[model samples]
Target: MQPCDLTSTGGATIASRFYEPPGRPRAAVVIGGAMGVKQDYYAAFAQWLAAQGYLVASFDYRGMGDSRHGPLRELRADLFDWAADFDTVIAATLLRGGGAPLYLIGHSLGAQLPGLLTHRDRVAGMVSVAAGSGYWRDNAPQLKRMVLYFWHVLVPVATKLFGYFPGRRLRKVGDLPVGVVLQWRKWCLNPRYHVGAEGTPVREKFEGARFPLVALSITDDELMTERGTHVLVDCYANAPRRVERIAPADVHARRIGHFGFFREQFQTSLWQRTVLLLQGFQPSQETAA
Candidate 1:
């Protein structure tokens, strides 16, 4: 693993890590992480992909992890800024790919934002895990009330007082920049979430994503129910998309929640299946473009 930095939009530097495979690579992969999650969380997965003959790149978005160079309260960023950060990572991954096919393994917010990137065409295919519209109302019954409580009561008060969300201290979510937390809150409140909340241009951009996408949702994911997953995948209306809802029993596991897919324990079951998808193994779940 090699530490690196890439320039994002507005001249900000994104902290990144690269994993190189032992010989001629079969393909290159860019692993995009979920919100408030650091790049290190995906380190094991990147190394596994590298061992599978893939060149892997993973990074922390600005205002998070190693990329958070300054005070979070002073950081000026929004959803678009995150999209640009993905674009930067995509470009770097494409370069490292060296004419090999490039693929993206996006988790949660990681999968949701790539549609907004202009450089998305650089990717040949995508594997989205636990991707979903974060609308609080669509949250699973067990989590809905808590989600509403956080968004309605805590989010506003905390962000206003701190100028950013102190999620780490609260143990609610990871610490988030004020703009990101606020913008995400707005999206989650809207019925159409990403589409209706982001406005027409972004909606069009989402539909314009015409690449192949394999979206995987876990039945046990409390944060992203089946409906929430489809709400997100449906935005890429023009893509040749496949939706697979996997249960914990499918992999002989006790549970695989929104974040469980990344646990090293699934290295053989879930992760290997993802490797096949990245290798261009097409399943029958695709909808025609």
Candidate 2:
């Protein structure tokens, strides 16, 4: 693992790790989770990518992990910030000393970030593990929906009311900035605003229209529903998109949730499947396309 840095759109220094195989590399970028997630979270997946003969670059967003941090009250942690950070990482690392075809693999929010960049075509292909199209339709059981709704509403209100939301107690939602909270709310509440022609400017920008795309979903993802993964498939304009479902039993002991799919025991299977997909193993319908 090699340490590296890239400048964010906000002019902050972004810290990252690059894993190169023993031989010349087949380049790939691996993006992990949302705010508060560290690059170390995907370390196993990076190693797997390296083992597959690909140079993997994984980074933390500015203000997260070892990257530069600003006043929590002042930073606007929006999805746009993620998109810009991804673009910066690509420019500084993957495209810096160009090698083999570039491929992108991201999980959860990381999956969403790649779709927003302007250079999707430059990439050889894309792999989205537990990817979401922003619609949380499968978040059923009215009580659960209410809980998520309350966090979506109250967290942002709390952040604006008091410079930072009391994050230590709530962990997930509270740690984010008001802008980021609002952006997520806008995407989740309105399915039409999440992807494809009906998506927001950010979603439209990242739409995988021309690239070969792969979408993978775990059966028991607590944070994202199967429908969220379906949204990704339906929204992509790519004619050759591939969708994969990893059974819960296959990843049981690993506790492969939305975040764990790119970590631990699931890493091997995920990487192997991704390598096969990238090597032209398309679903029957997409085979002729």
Candidate 3:
């Protein structure tokens, strides 16, 4: 992997890494990172994809990780801004990889925003991992209370007094800009989440998905329940969609939560499943596990 930088449409410098194989690539994959998660978290998986003959690019959204500069309080970025960052990464990846097929691997919030991408037509397919509605009520019962507290209580207070989320100090998640946190909070409070937040434009954007889409819901994911997963997939009203629920036992483990899918530990078990999906061998619903 080599260090690189991409300039966003609005001129923000996006820090990224490129994983390239020596020969002509079979496909190109753009990894859209989860909220509050850095691009580095997906490095191992990107390298593995490159080894399989795919050119891969992983990047940080503005106001997070390497893209962040100065004070977080100064950031005016919103969700659309981050989606634009993903658009920039996609364009850069496509330019570097030539005519190879383009695939998107969206993790968590990464999975939610792809439908809004301006260059959606260029993408051949998408794999969404733990992508779900952030409605606090839809969360698993065990996590509902905490989810409510975070969205209703903490987010507002922190963003008000500090100008940004104090995620580094509170350790809830990484530090987030005020606009990103508040906008996300507003969406999660609504039953329909982002679809409700943006209304008609976003709904239409989601409806335009005609390409193959695979939604991966981890059975034991504490952050996103089965209902949450369904809420996400249902938004892509016109897509060729497949839903798969994977239990830890299927991958011979005791746990595989929201964040486990990208960990290097699953290189053999869970990651291979992603490889097959990207390669166009869609298994029967039950065969996905």
Ranking by TM-score: 1, 3, 2
Ranked by lDDT from best down, the candidates are: 1, 3, 2
Candidate 3 residue pairs in clash (backbone atoms < 3 Å): none
> What is candidate 2's lDDT per residue for 63-86, written digit by digit as tens?
567773767677766767877788
lDDT of 1 by residue, 55-155 (tens): 89999999999999888999999888998998998898888777777788999999989899888777788999998888887888888968888998899
- Residue-level lDDT for 152 in candidate 1: 88
Better of 1 and 3 by lDDT: 1
**Winner of 2 and 3 under lDDT:** 3
Q: What TM-score fits each model?
A: 0.95, 0.84, 0.95
CA displacement after TM-score superposition, residue 105 of candidate 2 (Å): 0.9
Best by lDDT: 1
Per-residue lDDT for 207 in model 2?
52
The CA root-mean-square deviation of candidate 1, after full C-alpha superposition on the true structure, stands at 3.6
Deviating ranges (above 4 Å) for candidate 1: 281-289
Instruction: Please provide, for model 3 over 137-208, each residue's C-alpha lDDT reduced to its tens digit, 9 standing for 90 to 100.
Output: 888777786877898789989889999999989988779999999889888888988888789999999889
